[model samples]
Target: MTRAKVLLIGLIVLALGGVGYLGFEALGVRGFSAGIAAQSLLVLIVVVWTGSYLFRVVTGQMTYMNQRRRYREVYDAKEREDLEARFDALPEEEQQALLQRLGLDGDDVRADS
Candidate 1:
């Protein structure tokens, strides 16, 4: 695995272990009834955080797309049109290849046209 991915997984494991330990300590010191509640709360918080992190991971591409759109929005209309025009000036095959790399090319958008 990649170093970054290995690091991330290691951190996640450590976080889970720390939380579990804390929950167990709270249960032992607080007595059965209160400990159950504390543990429940801890588990709930971890679940929510993990779920949020997973959601962000799953939507990472969409997040990038939103950022790109926002970046384009920062340009004035004339500048945006000029940028588009420059892009359009590229040869059709190159344009299609670029779009394909971005996973955005469709069959209808022929490279030969």
Candidate 2:
């Protein structure tokens, strides 16, 4: 999820929890809020932090994608160069024989054979 979405969701959950805890404490049911508005501010701080964390993760993923694409281009170029080097080393007669066997000399190699 996006940073904004994460922050919104976290804030919602924190608000619900705080309200539930407050209600519980008032009813003498045992709870965790400490009964202070300032304490609830922690929820906002954490939500903002989590939002920044999520944004960093998204940017890191994009960076990885760009690095991977660059590596692929380099690898493909090397492979093509290697294949050309090997092909060029072959005798002209062998190269012609290979082309003929590949059916490149005729549309109907089987009929000709």
Candidate 3:
């Protein structure tokens, strides 16, 4: 992701590792075993977190995706409005001709309605 996010994750991992190591040592596990235990704890935590995030995404529970979808809908609506305005600006004969060419009834496509 971003550099800042990477740095923050690194810091969080380091902190977790340190806490895990100390916690294991306090429980009478020392040296290499403590280090391994701490590392394993970190791996487990990361795996669980990643799985949770993936589940949310797969279920469409991610807020970012929802926001993007909403933005796209709004953008599409604005584009449609702009196109309709341009079509309305065309001269009456041209508008009628365009509707006939497109097989649309002029009365049904009027902007005033």
- Alpha-carbon shift of residue 18 in model 1 (angstroms): 17
**Candidate 1 structure lDDT:** 0.71
What TM-scores do the predictions have? 0.34, 0.39, 0.71
Over the stretch 14-42, how does candidate 2's per-residue lDDT look in tens digits?
78667756776776755343455435655
Number of the candidate with higher TM-score, 1 or 2: 2
Best by TM-score: 3
Predicted structure 3: clash tally: 0
lDDT of 1 by residue, 81-100 (tens): 79668768999888888788
Worst 10 residues of 2 by lDDT: 104-113
Better of 2 and 3 by lDDT: 3
Q: Cα deviation of 105 in candidate 3 (Å)?
A: 1.5
Off by over 4 Å in 1: 1-30, 61-65, 73-79, 83-113
Ranking by lDDT: 3, 1, 2
The 0-to-1 C-alpha lDDT of every candidate, in the order given, reads 0.71, 0.70, 0.93
Ranking by TM-score: 3, 2, 1
Residue pairs with colliding backbones in model 2 are none
- 69 in model 2: Cα distance from truth in Å? 1.2
